[model samples]
Target: MSGRRGEAGSALVEVTWLAILLLVPLVYVVVGVFEVQRAAFASTAAARAAGRAFVLAADPAEAQQRARAAAAVAMSDQGVDGGAVVIGCRPACLVPGSVVEVQVSYQVPLPFLPDALGRQAPSIRVHAEHTVPYGSFREDRS
Candidate 1:
């Protein structure tokens, strides 16, 4: 009778500790997922900005440069300062129909948690392509 009561208390204590241990790792994984999603969103926005700039450019080389610049600007605006924005142009990225490809990379840190899950932190890459029609502007000479 007394032994059964003591066993119950010990079991409860053990279960409590186990719950805490499992909870920490679960929380860390959730946080890591959230960070990855944020990174993807930032990269996608940068790609879109770059693509828009490229499509409107008159010169292919200039367009590529402009796309890179736009991507950087967009990344900065999105509060992501540690990633690289790469713009690959025609023959490689641009199509005959005024399309551009933008590649964005971001390195994510591992959230604090137990390391038993073997989820190694890795850099994530997001690639996006956008096709834009060139905007027309009338030349003015006085």
Candidate 2:
């Protein structure tokens, strides 16, 4: 009977330790996944906003500037920073019926990671692309 009681106590302790060991990594993974998802959303918003800004601008130079600004705003709104916003035009930029493609890409660092891990800490890449077409009836001074 005494042996049984001791066994129960040790079993409880072992189980607790096991649970803690298992739980920590799970929590880490969940937090990392959430961060990656947030960055993904930020990138998506940046791409869409950039494409719209490009389409609305009067000329190529202004279009590029507006697109970058819009992309930065969108990413910053979600607490993300330093992502690339690239604009590519199809069939000539600013012309009626031209298509502009905006791409936003960034790296999301994993949670609970240390810089000592490497110069490039473990990270997830969040990327998004959006396309906006210049309105067929849209005419502006350039």
Candidate 3:
């Protein structure tokens, strides 16, 4: 009976060790997935907002400024960096029926990863694009 009593705690110790090793990694993966999803959502929203803002502007110069501002605001609202926005415009963007395109990109860092391994760990890049067409009623002031 004495010999059996000492070995009883051994199973509990083994189980605890296994749980720690598995659960920690599982939690990290879940958090990383959530971060990626957030980046995707932010990028999409930023592109849409930028395109719409550009089409509604009074002139070409104002359109560019407004698009950038709108994209920045949209990304920031979702806790993403707004500096990565890229706007692409079709020829004669202010002309009637012209198209305005906006693209937003974000790099999502891995959760609980060391900065030193940043190069080794592949960062997820999320990108979204939206195109808006100018109204047919737009007047050609030039």
Candidate 4:
């Protein structure tokens, strides 16, 4: 009975160690995946909002400014910071039926990593692009 009791404790210790070694890392990986997915969602939303803002603006200069602001706001809402945004227009901007494209890029750092290590770690980058057409009813300014 004494030997059997000792062996029972040993099995529990082994299981505890296994959980520590395996389960913890698994949980971290799952959380990291969730963060990356969040970044991806943010990027897509930013691009779409920027493109729509650009298309709705009345002038080319205003379109660029609105697109940038819209993208920044969208990304910040999702807990992402310092994301890069790019905007492009087909043919000429502010023209009726012109297509506006907005792209957002975000780098997601791994959780629990030190700054130096995080910088060295392979970053998960999420990119999204959206295109919207300008209103066809707008009168040509030129």
Candidate 5:
């Protein structure tokens, strides 16, 4: 009876400790995963939006400007910083039947990590590429 009484509270204490130990890591992992997912979403949307903007622009200079602006907006909407957007065109840009490829890339810092860690901190890089085709019958602005 004395032994049972002593063991009664031991199980509760053990469980509480175990829960605290397990839950902290579990919560950290979940937050990291969510942040990476958000970055992925932002990159994908940025690439798609930038590609479309590039193809719709009236001039080469405007196309580049619009592509960057569109990509920045898309990334910002997902709570990510304005990332890099690189555009490449097939043969010639703003030409009929040409295809424009836009790539969006950014790094997702680990959950609860500070920038002071610099490159030493673990981070996940997310990249997305989208291609838009200028209509065959459209006027060539190149």
Candidate 6:
């Protein structure tokens, strides 16, 4: 009877330890998901701003410059100015009445968890792009 009692206690201890071990990974996954979501929002905003800038630009080169500046402003607003946001032309992309592509990219840092789980913090880079028609109505006109 004593031997059985001892075994039961050991089993409970093992279960508790296992639960604690699992909790770390669970928490990490939840936090990481939220961080990724925040980054996605930032990227989307940057892309939209870039697209708007391009649409307002007078020429291709000016469009590119505007795109970059717009993305920078968006990034700054989102508290992610340190991250990179790139704007590029797609072929003969900036013709009047054509579609202009704006790309926004950034690296998101995942905070470190405990080393007992043998997991290292991860930094993931994400990108978002948007295309807007060149002839769309401008804000100033409205």
Q: Which parts of model 2 have CA positions greater than 4 angstroms off?
A: 140-142
lDDT of 3 by residue, 1-142 (tens): 9879878879889999999999998998899999999889988998999999888788778888898899888888989876477776666777876777788888887777676754666688888988887766888522
The deviation in Å at residue 73 for candidate 3 is: 1.0
* Candidate ranking (TM-score, best to worst): 5, 2, 4, 3, 6, 1
Off by over 4 Å in 3: 117-122
For each candidate in turn, the TM-score is 0.64, 0.90, 0.86, 0.88, 0.93, 0.65
TM-score of 5: 0.93
lDDT of 2 by residue, 1-142 (tens): 8768757668788999999999999998888888999899999999999998888887889889999999999999999987988889888888777788999999998877788746867788888999888877878434
User: Considering every candidate listed, which one attains the maximal TM-score?
Assistant: 5
Model 5, runs deviating above 4 Å: 115-119
Model 4 lDDT tens row, 27-134: 999999999998999999999999988877777788888889998899889888868999987777878767778889988988877668445765788899998877
Give each prediction's root-mean-square deviation over alpha carbons: 5.6, 1.7, 2.3, 2.1, 1.6, 5.4
Q: lDDT-based ranking, best first?
A: 5, 2, 4, 3, 6, 1
Which RMSD does model 2 reach against the true structure? Answer: 1.7
How does candidate 1 fare on TM-score? Answer: 0.64
- Residue 25 in model 2: lDDT: 92
lDDT of 4: 0.85
What tens digits encode model 6's per-residue C-alpha lDDT throughout 60-131? Answer: 677778888888778778677555656554445555445667777787877564444676555788889887
- Candidate 6: Cα lDDT at 2: 72
> Runs in model 6 with CA error above 4 Å?
1-19, 58-62, 89-94, 113-121, 136-142
What TM-score does model 4 achieve against the real structure?
0.88
* TM-score, predicted candidate 3 vs. hidden true structure: 0.86
Worst 10 residues of 5 by lDDT: 113-122
